[model samples]
Target: MKMNPLKVIKNGVITENPILVQCIGLCPALATSTSAVNGMGMGIAAAAVLVGSNVVISAIRKFVPDEIRIPIFIVLIAGFVTVTQFLISGFFPELDKSLGIFIPLIVVNCVILARAEAFAFKNGALDSLFDGIGTGLGFTIALTALGAARELLGNGTIFDIKLTPAGFQPGLLAILPPGGFIALGIFMGAFRKYQERKAARQGKPEPVHAAGCAGCAMSGQCGAAAKGGGN
Candidate 1:
């Protein structure tokens, strides 16, 4: 089947947003979103890793043993992450510092592994590239939005420029670790509500399962409730 680049991009940016919708790669999403610059840097680094890993995985899928596919994907992903980490450290020192350990931690990010296993392995190289781009863009958008919100509230700035009037005290909590969790939870709730409302407005059949909740690591908890009519 022919792949649609536009559709792939759109899926990553909104429909299957890795952070806001899929809730994958939450560690970097939370850790690096303290500032817009940091978030964007992390996003770009992750995008590079995702794209590189996807392309490599797609090209090698036929050669890899099924039993060892997971390990192979991890090695490929880790290699790309390592490359990105060094590039950032060598060139964008400030960003490297801002992103910190999160950059190296991308080696194990579920987003990369998920795409390699699910889409890249089965798709053509070009299609896998688009998928990676889409997923990366989605992740970037989510992180940027969250970062903007956090920075604006926590520091009274956007991208380090003052936004609020003079004498306004920033809300320190917004940039704190706990705030990341709170912000993400609120965004997820809002997204679910939006989906529900959109389905109702379109007269679409109510979804049998929650979006992105299926196949999740914690699905046993959510899925059990969903099956029991507790959702």
Candidate 2:
């Protein structure tokens, strides 16, 4: 396929990170990323499934009926995820136990399905393979970073090795569920800032996000509801 592999990978990791930029698959990302190993393990496992499913879906796209394509895509994804789970369990018992049910849950992750629908089906198998590789790396980078941060802050360690001074008190909350949101928020803010700086350095205009509910980060804090009620 006529594709720039590095560019595609860069887009996935920096521009369209599944967790950091797209904000998809947060539940699994947050739940299993309490430590670096868990995060890395989950990321790699999900990436493998994503890559396999994307390539297979792209290869078989021609025959899939329009109405049932979603089901077919999901089935393909589930098959890949099942294999990935088994491989993980056999090779990385600690990771399998640490990640728990989240590994199987990869079947439903929006990132994988979104890629299947948006990129794989429309692209050639070779392109889809690279796309999968790129996006998977993005998923891995985001999770690993988040997990590392949480691990370091919460336990004063990374990959189970001490990195902090003896006097440092581990920030217990950093490993909790709330820590995920807080750490993610900080990462998002930093990512945006990095994008802004990169744009400035490149002498390009700052990217502006679409305004209003379609792109709003508030989820559903809509003033429109109250305005409609009043009217």
The C-alpha TM-scores of every prediction are 0.90, 0.89
Model 2 vs. true fold: TM:
0.89
Give lDDT tens digits, candidate 1, residues 110-207.
78887887788899899999999999988887888889999998999998899899999998999999988898888778887887788899999754
Per-residue lDDT of 1-231 in model 2, one digit per residue for the tens? 477878877877778777877777788898988999889888999899889998999999999997899899888999999899889899889889989999999998878887888788888998888888998999988899999999999999999999999999999999999999899889978888888899999999996642322222222434465456553
RMSD of each: 3.7, 4.1
Native-vs-model 2 lDDT? Answer: 0.85
Off by over 4 Å in 1: 207-231
TM-score of 1: 0.90
Clashing residue pairs in all predictions, respectively, total 1, 0
